[model samples]
Target: MSAFPEFIPSKLSFHLDSRLVTAVAVAAALYYALYRLQKVKIHPNEPPIVASKIPFVGPLVGMVLDGGRHVKSIGLLNRDKPIFTLPVPGSRIYVVTDPALAAAVQRASKELSWTPLIPELTKRVMGLDADTVGVVAQNLDPEPDEPHGFLADLHDMVYAYLGPGESLNALSLAAARELGRQITAHAAQLEQQSETVDLLAWVQHFVTIGTAQYLYGPENPLARDPRLEQAFWDFDHGLGRLLLGFAPSLVARKPYRAREALVAGLEEYLSAGRHEVGAAPIVQRRIEIAHLHGFSVAATARSELSFLFAGIVNTATSTFWTVLQVCARPALLAAVRAELAAVVEETATGERRLSMEALKGACPTLHAVFLECLRVGSDSYTSRLVKNDMLLAGQWHLKAGSVVQIAGGVLHADPGIWGADADAFDPARFIRLGEGKVLPAAFRPFGGGKTLCPGRHFATHEILAFVAMIVLTFDLEAVHSDENISVPPKEDRVLPVHILEPRTDVFVKVRVRDARAVVVV
Candidate 1:
């Protein structure tokens, strides 16, 4: 009863206790009144503001609690206004639901920019050092012929090498060949053991090994240590927390330790100069640029972790879902296999090969299925910071320094844009897209504009090749009869920067197909 010292002898203590009591009372009142503070004022011509029910902390709290659904909640108000503002603690985010407004923001490139955010995110999420962050921010938004930041140079280097040309083709060829080898060995082992395999785990392992083989080479750091594979996923899943300023080393110890451990392995790998030993052209050049920008060997390795994370995680997750979708539908599975089989040819020497070039365009249904899975399963946002006050799309004033969120979940499911079956899986959807009947903006699983994913082509080819290989040669089914293969439920808090991984483990019985099939040559 006397814990608070109601009869305190010290005046200063009494004063502090009284102030603390008032502070606690005010905090309680604010918490209780937040629900009633739902009407946010909107000035004429200003973007309509959606008052979050939780007062100052609403938007971020919603994100933490509901994932992409919170962004969609902001979108609910978009029906009345093409653009609306989501008020955060000290700032506002302009949410654009109308595709036309989204394109305007995309084209208004300079006024709304990814420049300021990218450096900050890199520093926070990737856990880059102060020197490295300086290097990354140095050339941010460079003038023509002016010195660009390490990131700008690095991005240019990535695009230059990943584009349609010798470099990209070489990387693709190496990756496809190595991936085939890994699949063949793994599938053979699976058939021999006739075991229950976690569908997502098998896919993640093969894809990581295959992708890492090309990025880091045969003596790859990840493959050398089996634990690193799971570590990568652990680190990826915790990215949102890291980005939200919950970045103390102990706050997210699991991912932080895993990431640092991987970085240490990468440092050890690079120390031996194995990156030059048959590394992808992209890898070699990225290392050069990192060194030019003053990154130490350890820093360069740490930076490459981003590439490894992106290359493996997104493609692997999508591939797992694509495989699941095909398995669940009989007609789609048969059609895809038929399309793939037709593309494979037997050689005089008795070896068969499916032309990678042919796979890119020949299998229309496979393309549709892959794209549809992405569209339906994707839940993310593409954000750009507002650099100046401007009239957006000739209406709606967006204040300077505010942020704009281009939500994929809302766009992908918009009935007006995608027709009545927008929410359903239609593998033939891209067929129409190919026919030029629909606007390209309607399908944005990989995002669009100046920020369009540079790894799209690489990722697409890799995913298709991997999915095609498994489905064509292996027969898979869920172990429990009651269990079914379908799009795994998404988590409550999926990150925009993440590839969609199933919320739970998907276990299946896998075996070699009895039907005659083409072998990867």
Candidate 2:
């Protein structure tokens, strides 16, 4: 039998179908009309909206694809505007591009607060349970008469330890001492012979170990197991997706796995009583505070992961860039080396030591180089959720439930603040500005106000120490074909961060200096 049926219509069944075509066209037009209506409605009192061609969907998609670069592009396009609104599907982000407005946003701590997001981050990113999240959420925005809660206590504790005082000095010195020891050991290994290395990787490895050993003590998990260190970085790279909390195991598989490994290691560290034995006082206090707030040992460990990340990641990246900036430039390197030599002294036993205090206070040229590095290299966003409708700079109106992000990268690039050479890397920029002239308020590397980084003192000390050690003890030459060594382009497209990381590895030849030949003391 034939497969085809003879009764099938050849011509009668297929007509022009003008009616169906008309219906499709009408539906598409109507759908687009509603889509346009759904776009953000701006009031005269509100900051002017910078609308995307694709309405609400475009801004969100741009953020998902470009990370912080999208914000920077929008900023560059609207450099004259101090503030503008970016509307996404669910919310509006008021981007503050002007340094004055940025300062205002930070000053309005109660109206535009960072505390509101802490619970969400603790629950979703740190994997805390609902009860623990509730504990954190309580009194987040307490009334005038209401007593301050867990969050307040945590803040006070952190500030007490990390603020500019005796505790801060001890912590900073400990970190510096640990890093110095690592540098000395590494230099000894390179004696009389050059070793080629990926500069950023080399910096990250030692910084991670040095910072962790001091913060988490001898039983530091990252130092004990190298795999955990790799895992921590993997998790950091995928942090944007992880923050969304949308089935991370499926969407961000590698980062999710890495997070699990870190959490497990942290749990083991805490459970085995390693923290009590040799961990930093702040670390011990952190564990204690979490337990005080009804957190389980596992949840406490998970919470500690955020601390570990904050402790080392940006410091490592900043140190890498600072070292690169100084060493890549011959004159700057020579100047920094000479300045560092003032801090080096020899005891009666012939043991040489680099004075941490002198490095912090006496080395003006080195300090300038470090500050210039931060000014040009920092790409962080200082974000606050607008808790109440407020007037910023007594002009632009910010609505409640919206976010106000002070774009540090955009501000850093403002020629008005940083001079015409804002985009260029000038090691002497800070020195040129000098003490009599007030530095621009746009230089917000450590952020500002209540949300300012408490660890700033420690990070500054540790980075300077690392750089001083390297500059004094070794010679770093870029392993490049060209005679002039170039610094690597920044990895701007990664996670929105305080420090921009290098996009590519820079290979450099490291040669240890002869102790007898070098001018020390």
Residue runs of model 2 more than 4 Å from their true location after superposition: 1-40, 143-145, 435-441, 514-521
How accurate locally, in lDDT, is each candidate?
A: 0.78, 0.81
lDDT computed for candidate 2: 0.81
Name the runs in model 1 displaced over 4 angstroms: 1-43, 481-486, 514-521
Model 1 TM-score is 0.90
Model 2 C-alpha RMSD vs. true structure (Å) is 3.5
| TM-score of candidate 2 against the unseen true structure | 0.92
lDDT of 1 by residue, 30-124 (tens): 77776455345344677876766677578888888777777886785466667787777667888877778778878888788887887778877
Best by TM-score: 2
Model 2, 104-149: lDDT tens per residue?
8877888999999888986767778788888888887677588776
